[model samples]
Target: MSAPANAAVPQAEQSLRDTVLSRGYLRLLLLCVLLGVPIALACFFFVGLQHLLQHWVWESAPEALGYAGPPWWWPLPALVLAGLILAPIVTRVPGSGGHLPVNGLGGAPVGPKELPGTVLAALATLPLGVVLGPEAPLLAIGSGLALLAVRRSAAADAKARAVVATAGSTAAISTILGGPIAAAVLLIEGAGLGGARLVALLLPCLLASAAGALVFTGFGDWTGLETGALALGELPSAAGPDVGDFLWGLPVAALIAVLVTLGRELGRSTVGFTRRGSKAARTVACATAVGVCITAYALITGRSPAEAALSGQATLAELAADPHAWSVGALVALVACKGLAWAVSLGSLRGGPIFPAVLLGTATATAFSGLPGFGTAPALGLGIAAAASATTGLPLASAVLAALLLGGDAAEQMPLIVAASVVAFIVGQLVRRQRPEGATDTAGAAGAAR
Candidate 1:
């Protein structure tokens, strides 16, 4: 009787395991399809929107507000009004107007109900030159909407909810990255997912990315904007790293790591300071200061003020394409100016730091490209990857992003980028580790006191 009872117990446990696995796998597949398609589509839509806006909306809107136009000071009043409105929205809204971009990049996820406010807030804030990127809001809004859709149609299970939310977030910025693969990898690695679950999660992300590419391609076609090419023209050939190049890169990366750490600290301190002040006062003051800095940079460097104020992608691309256009002094100035501007933006505004960081890194590399053994393109590529990795602590994502941006040269430059990133990561980790535990406790207490 004992032996028979034991046999039945094992059988019952096996049956339960089978049921769970069966359901889990099935739910996983469903999540992949639902989230993947929407994310890809959203990415597609965003790309299309950007293209249209660049070519048509902004171009067609009056020259005053267009890219070629002078900086629109008239928008300042509206922006201030928006900030006033946003303060209340942020205070009243659940999840503080949805998950912040910084939090999302740091691996936080958002739910369905928060999508609308996230999108609206980001669109309003970013275009006003609030010194942020759309990436974070993109993730929050995308995931939130996806979750809302799924919950309405399907029964809510914890696993299912997580899977769908993840998928939505993945879909949101699938195309902002060169491809869906990088975004998927970022989400998977950042989340620390593993085993069969990783495989299951990747399927939906990949599918969504592919869908996003297609959607973006279609929209580009309709809008007459160039789209769908992942590679930037022909891949530039990479020059092998000489011994001196490696040595120089190590020090450059270390210096950059320190600068990045400082920038982060500055941003945190500024944010803390601003939080103690009136929101309206802080926002206006920060924006005015950013505008003054941008105007000064442009006046001193003979570049457009807008160049200093925007995401700096276009400027980075130009610098990468022609390193000699700007002198080393100019590049260094831009880096300093951009870094300070970015830090300021983080204090009182909302946006993603990713693009600005990449811009600064690429600019730094370009500035130093004339040194022996370091050419323009390779330096730009390596620096961008290393700086991004150091700040974000997403080494793989940074490597892949830099590689994608570098096109065919990716294989050749991958080794150096990886090496530099390792050094930068070590530097970052070391600095983080060295911070006193009590300092964090004190900071937390201070924040609480406010």
Candidate 2:
């Protein structure tokens, strides 16, 4: 009887442990859901703010002054002004105006103290026509906000706080690029998390993401503003992948890897190139260089300066909507100018590298579609994937993003996109020189490229 009673105690303890874990997970799920609403709301507001400023500064104000479009020189003073405003914030504020997105996508969590600097930097650069995306800034914002939330809540343990912070990031990024799955891929690959730890992180992320996406959808409908989701709109009918398609995709991916690596390396060099200068001087000089790049694109393509501005989201939609309308010359100009702008932005501005890369990828792929046996759809898909991989170093995530962006066309194009992603990622690794650990050279300033 004594032995049986002792065994019962062990079973009881085990049962209690299992019950506690189950309850803990459930509570976490609830926390994620609750957090999702506010993060989504915050994202909605941020998007609106960016749009409002872009319209008044880049479009409405120019129109109010009676110009049909901003002249080629329009961005010069605009960028200078942005640099002036952002210099102090990035240099003096906590978080260095947020980690440069070119360095990598989600790194350490942004503290509440650093959140303001991140927001200020993005607001200063993005609406003023810096060729960067909102993704990185939003990631920081989400992480910061989540950390703040956890600080205010009952979660005092280190593990709980980290989980909540990650959940916040996932919720914030869920709908911005495409959906929860994309967010999952980005966080998983970018963080290098796997196995049981990956599963734990992923559940809260998925839960928060689902809730956040729902909120974004509902709020977007209510507000009637585009929620900044990537949609390829329409794609040409894709033929199944053939040997010839892979052959072309291989070269295309290689080219993309080189272009991305070269651009990032150039951007990284700027950190040291301007390190000795005052923050204001560096910011002004870099912004001016970006303005020059945009002007060159306008002059070369004979398009409005606005076409080369922003994060390149609208331009990507335009390319997908009417590929025939964009001459090869125009596409080349866009890629060249945007690459230059991307480098400058990476060096000085506060934004993500994602949108510009996507646009460049689309243009490059479309331009090369005339190659024998490289159909339009496969080339376009491969280009987008390779370019994304080049920038991000996360081939799997990049492939998913590219395929999903193709919208209805993904079913037929997934194989080609996957192949391109793998090839580009491997080639990018070969072409990219690893940064020495703890060195504050340009590459460290950038993060990982994506």
Candidate 3:
């Protein structure tokens, strides 16, 4: 006489409806709407400042020194300075510079006390070319700022605080993901929302994101400040997937998954290494090693070290706009150098992992564009989807993210993108599961460092 699964649906629906109608939820909805604007504004300023500082360090300073761009040795000093600044924050700061990127963006919401450390760590390192993204720090900042709005008495209600924090996070993250839809899908898939709880949380998040998007749109127009969001502008034309594209995309996606998994393994090893010695010294050593990797890429390819040093947003855009700019051999070197820097940064630095992984995927896929059936556009889309799915372990979100990045051409390439995402997701899971039991536990070890 157990209740049927179908029977639970109505009860869940009724509970969701009741919850939505409740006064507390109504208040929360209002709070989310109100909070979204400010949260997005804060994120806007944060991202804007980070970009400005980055431009100064990499562009202005080098130009002042009469170089076309940063010299090959430029990253060494910049990264050393970054390490010196970041070491103290990671060791002494309350949040340990926020969670290590190897943990894949799942953790408790940050509180106000940890906000300074998180922001300082990102500003200090990311602008100095740490090969990490700003998403995690933005997430931490949003959640912390939101929690700060709660009354001391209300703080005891963990559930309400979490919801508000999530809403704030969605709003802040929405600014960077171009808009709320991809951000919402990302959080939904990453958090595994379902059932009544899903319905309950979805409303607040959606409201916050929508409101935040509106504010960001208006503010950018008014202030004329660049948000430096992750988006591609001029992509090469693409057509619908033919049988050949699908056939070739499968193994390509799997290969990307394997490559990304290897990067994560390297991150685990870094976590283990950082744990053994004086944490501060070890962190600086990892940072300097990342600098060496960037220097190696610049020396070998005769390109700017910036290409291999920071989060790969600009390089990705450049690659999408003109894949021909990079020779296959150069792309391979970019992959090798940037991939190692990214892997080390993942366990020792404070930033998001998804951006560089997407770049890595794109580089790898673009190298294979000359394959029998693979066109450059299809290769680009497949690489983006596969890398994103593998790195984040959220196939549906990765598909949406890839489609968003691919822009109008994505409509034609959706099928290929979806297939690649699914393939990469499955392959990534298999790779992780296949790791030996004695292997360094990337998530656990990285989490401990945090």
Candidate 4:
């Protein structure tokens, strides 16, 4: 045989080995470990950056100028600045500001050109107090980063690419909300697959999510931010599923579904209206409207504008702890203002939708808790489950996220959360069916991912 032919034999055998390894579970597990580390680190950095920026903008900068709290008008210019920074990117860049959180998660993998735009836009809107979350943008960033890493390796097939992307997404969002299971449910639901195919996709997700959570916990300990997951500082004694709890859960779900659907319709309308103008012009208009809504919340409730803006992460803990802190009137003002701001975010800003939806649900449920037979815990779980279902259109995911948010009490509240989620899911489905032919879905991001 010729020398060239002899060399080809080894190369072909090597290629065959690589392909087999990539397909095997062992290789996938190995890749999960390797990819999870960097993805987890990246998530840490991304989260840390958001935290630092929020502090600087809301706390440090204000204190520097000798102000006790930011003036009431602070959100107006801050949001207007959000428009200036994000307008061009959403319009001029690719990926359309990273998949529009209102559309749900997981699309064709984002490209290199579009990835930076996602990062830039997220950085701009979130820290400045736009009513959005880090989940959607983080998904895109993690997926984009994963694809880049795999392109250099042997497992570059379509299946491999999909797995890598899924893993990256799991890692990216692992610690943002509650647990790895939440991330897994979200990716599985969003993928819209089933049977053996779903299982195949789910394996990598589980591994990656586990790794990401471990890393997030470690990082939190190292840095002392203690923010890898959501926690309720106070807990009200929860009653198990009572007849009244189940009976009233339906009405609560029905009411929240209607409100959320209305918000969705508003977002759709805003999108149409904004499309009429230039990108920058549309962003400015939407952002200014957002500012107005937030200002209204602050003015009406005598709460900080921060309560009305951002992803609602900071506010969720407090609201969960003390449902009685605000009167019914204050709670109503909060829901109205926050919902309006959330709608505006969907129409204009670039961030995730999930956190804001949960916040809205938390407020509504807490308000309803004042009625007969409903305790604070039950109301919170029901409200969260219903709002999540309405916004994300995923019953299972919404249930899981709601239960997990209860932390150590998750097991005890599982039945109630699941029931509420189911009720909300049915109501949401019925309401959606009744919409006009061209009606839009509710605006939000990852199950609290936004």
lDDT of every predicted structure (CA atoms): 0.63, 0.77, 0.83, 0.75
Residue-level lDDT of model 2, residues 226-260, one tens digit each, is 86687566466555556567678779878888888
TM-score of each: 0.76, 0.83, 0.86, 0.82
Model 3: per-residue Cα lDDT over 1-450, one tens digit each: 467988989999999999999998998899889988999999999999999999999999999999999999999998888888888988998998888898777677788998889998998889999998888888887788888887474433777877888888888878878799988887766665463465345435533553455456457667999899666664665566666777887798899999998898789889889989799999999999999999999999999999998889999999999999999988999999999999999888889898999999999999988889888888889899999988887776787889899888886677678778877877888887465665433221111112
lDDT of 4: 0.75
lDDT of candidate 1 over 1-450, digit per residue (tens): 799998999899999888768976677767667667767777577645644543332234446454565443433443454466556556556665543333226433566555666666666555554555667666666666766776766476665666667667666767677768877766765664454365345435543553454456456556898755665464457654555566677678776777766676677667676678676577566666666666666666776555566566767778777778887777777878778877776656665677777787777766776888776666876788777776676666777778788887765565566666666656766664354554321100011011
**Over 4 Å off, model 4:** 1-23, 195-237, 433-450
TM-score winner: 3
lDDT measured at residue 431 in model 3 versus the true structure, 0 to 100: 87
Total clashes in model 1, counting residue pairs 3 or more apart in sequence or in different chains: 7
* TM-score, structure 2 vs. true: 0.83
Residue 388's lDDT within candidate 2 is 87
The weakest ten consecutive residues by lDDT in model 1 span 441-450
Using lDDT as the measure, the top candidate is: 3
Query: What is the per-residue lDDT of model 4 for residues 240-283, given as tens digits with 9 covering 90 to 100?
Result: 54556656766887788777766766776777777885867988
